[model samples]
Target: MNRFPLGVWLFALALAAVTALPYVAGALNAPSATLYSGAALVPSGAAVDYNSHLAKMWQGRRGEWDYQLLFTHEAHPGLPLVQGFYTLLGALSPFDLALTYHLARFVLTIGMVLALWVFASHFFETPSARWICLLLSTISAGWSWLLLFVPGATAQVGPIEFWLIDAYNLIGALFMPHFAAAVILQIAAFLTFEAWVRSAGAAWRGLLLLTALLAAMGIVQPYIILLSLPLLLILLGYYVISAKLLTWRRALWLLLPLAAHTALIVYQYVAINNDAVWRSFSEQNITASPDLLYYILGYLPFIIPILIGARTFVVDEADDRWWLPLLWVLLVAMLLYAPFPTQRRYLLGVQTPLAVLAAYGWTRAFLPRISAGRRPLLTGVYVTLTALAPALLIFANINAFAHPQMPATTAVYYSADELIGYEWLRGQANPDDLVLTTFGWDGQGSGGRMVAALGQRVFMGHWIETTRFEEKIAQIASFYNPVVPDEWRLMFLQNNGARYVWYDDSARVLGGWNPADAPFLEQVFSSGSVTIYRVRLNG
Candidate 1:
């Protein structure tokens, strides 16, 4: 019996345990009031992305292919393969939505870590260096010392966004499915490429695997493929120049799969751009772009090590494998500054290659000078220094969960009864039926965005989703405004194809009119602070 298999299993179990530790603490020590108020134990506002996926999963179970991602304008393509797997598991044994979500996240996180370890092995022969790379990849943090010394830095730039940094693997894995999948696929692709480079017998097998992974990446997260293209091209150039057999003809042959992958990506974007609704929606929802200095500050841990590693590579031609990771970092950095809505998101899986480079720097540059006995102590010091910022961030998130600082209106607004209301709405309404509600963030009532997602129904939920958001919001306000005549309100609802109007405490604050008072609206359901009224189109 091989103990190696047992050892690997135990190691995986340990990783899972460590990964779940903070979440376990969060659940156990969640603010009593918040727990009672139906808030998720992890955090609020983090659910926006996860909720969208949950919506798709819910739809997927019903054999529906299209997802009404409320944050976007129209029904976007769902990750059927990913969602379908979960749906099948859900069918076999039921679990709480949040529990299932976290479980999936846990699996993906473990996969990412394992993939990073495998990828690092190609560049590093020493077990110590490989393990160091793995740990640094998982826990490395940004430069927070600069903020402490610089005047007004914290106030001007806000706290370091740990979620944006490459080393914050837990955040990406736990909260985002696409991100986790992309990370796994990206590393898997890299591993296959490396194997292809080294193998003589099964090189075609490696190419095939790499192509499948790249295509899967397109489906899992198109943006990842976009970021990966330049890096792949750089790798092709490296092989053409360095390898004897990798002549232009063979390199072009290698490029075929990538070219096809790129075409698919272009086609997907063209389809998105051609759709009037999706185009407007994506344009409106474009995230605020960050500056180069902001990116430098965020990835300083990896950047510093990579710079050192670059010098080592240049000076020593024997370690030519270093060129791959160096190119990866440079290409990704270029894409980060590329003019795009969500360029920052490309940083998700970069820690893998950076970890490799950083490990190289540590072993080649830093460790050679130290005595064997003293290396462990110095390594501890290096790791602690690297991990400082992430530790602070993890502590901040935990503290926020235990002693929440967000306003009650924003944090604990969604009660269990309200979620029940949304579930009930899902059961009652047709999937295509549009529900009209307030479109702004009032922070006082149940959000229509939640209703759109959890209810699995179409809605004029928020400005991000609704076309002509200001006008729609104003119209909704007028429809609920007590001063507005009942006839005008009725007309507005009919014009917008609104079959139902959901009113909550926030709605009352924004619009003085009550649904029960309108002759053209019939109260269908009422529970706690929520009320649902069916529009009396006939009347």
Candidate 2:
């Protein structure tokens, strides 16, 4: 129990509860007039992003083995392996989408907390240091939280302090399991490789574990390699040069898993690039890193201890364990600004290593210098300050749920009739059928994404997945406008090969044109204000 203590379990469960509570409460309290999406209320909350993931999960539920781009309408060669995580979940889930998603999320949340704790345990001798590291890594948001109060700061600064899920543990788990899974996989791979390095007789076991973890990563989010590979390489390089472990045969064994990871990633890249539709989606999916200052401020109190740990490591070269976390912190710091499109992905659980270093630094370096009585006081101050961002996150999420109609929440709802309309259309439309609806995902735009995610291919949805997002948005607006001639509308429908028109409450505000006025339209389904029209030949 000391190794995997009760405290970690308690801490993990508490965080998981915090993450799950608002969404559960929101669902229970939702009025019968509307169907709760079972997503947290939002400014970039669980629902918006998960809709895309839920789409993949929805496909899995339908027994579609291949990963199809459901957000955008196109016939492209789908992958059997890519993003198969959600697909796997969909296949395994007996519950509805929302329930399955939350259950998986809760489990993954607990797993992520435990994973971070285990990873930290390797570095810190005392449970106190490990626990402190866990707190810092999981929740320390720094001065970045202060930016939320600033009039224009969060937008200008990238909101890494509090909003970005990949930037922190609690938010990451709260957003989606894939985010936390990325971290989990990385820790598992690192530890497995580390074990392989130390164990002479059963080194083959490490290689096999590495292969499995990397393969799992391929399905979960291959972009995670943008962080994991460099750190592993650093470990390998240090071992080869400093420890003199570079007997060629042993080196080759270690190199094999690294090679496997690279080869799999390269193949995935080639496969994605081979598909025109998916390639376009990939090209549009850019997550460039924000300024370095954002990160420095975002990590706050942990940064000081991380630096102390680094200095101590540099000065002493005492513990090899210190080497890994210190190098991880430095490498990630540099990678955050690399010219790669997904540079910000390097932020994935970086705070974990930094927190490990911080705990090491404070206990080993800082504490001995201070008086014992004052040490607890200093630690108390540190914990309180570090707790700021996490406390704010909890408050913000709860507040959003309490006031569902707040500006931050947006149009995070679907009417009962709207869901029923989707159900009827899902039964009618084939897998490849194209759905045309207003371009908006939240607020004024039609819930085309909701339609798309529920298993139909929409004409356009999603910021990144949808090819030519702005152009399609304009074209969709024009298509919805009453002033547009039926000839143009007919041509637009035919040209895009859109099989169904989704006109819901939001779409109604865009234009009041009746489908009966159009010669090529046949009303196939209607529920209250929501209408589904099937395209037909004018003859």
Candidate No. with top lDDT: 2
Candidate 2 per-residue lDDT over residues 18-44, each given as its tens digit: 878778767765665766676665446
Candidate 1, after superposition: displacement of residue 27 in Å?
A: 4.7
The lDDT of each candidate is 0.63, 0.75
**TM-score for each predicted model, relative to the true structure:** 0.86, 0.94
Off by over 4 Å in 2: 148-155, 405-410, 441-444, 447-449
Clashes of each: 0, 1
Worst 10 residues of 2 by lDDT: 443-452
TM-score of model 2 relative to the true fold? 0.94
**What's the true lDDT of residue 126 in model 2?**
83
Clashing pairs in 1: none
Show the colliding residue pairs in model 2: 440-445
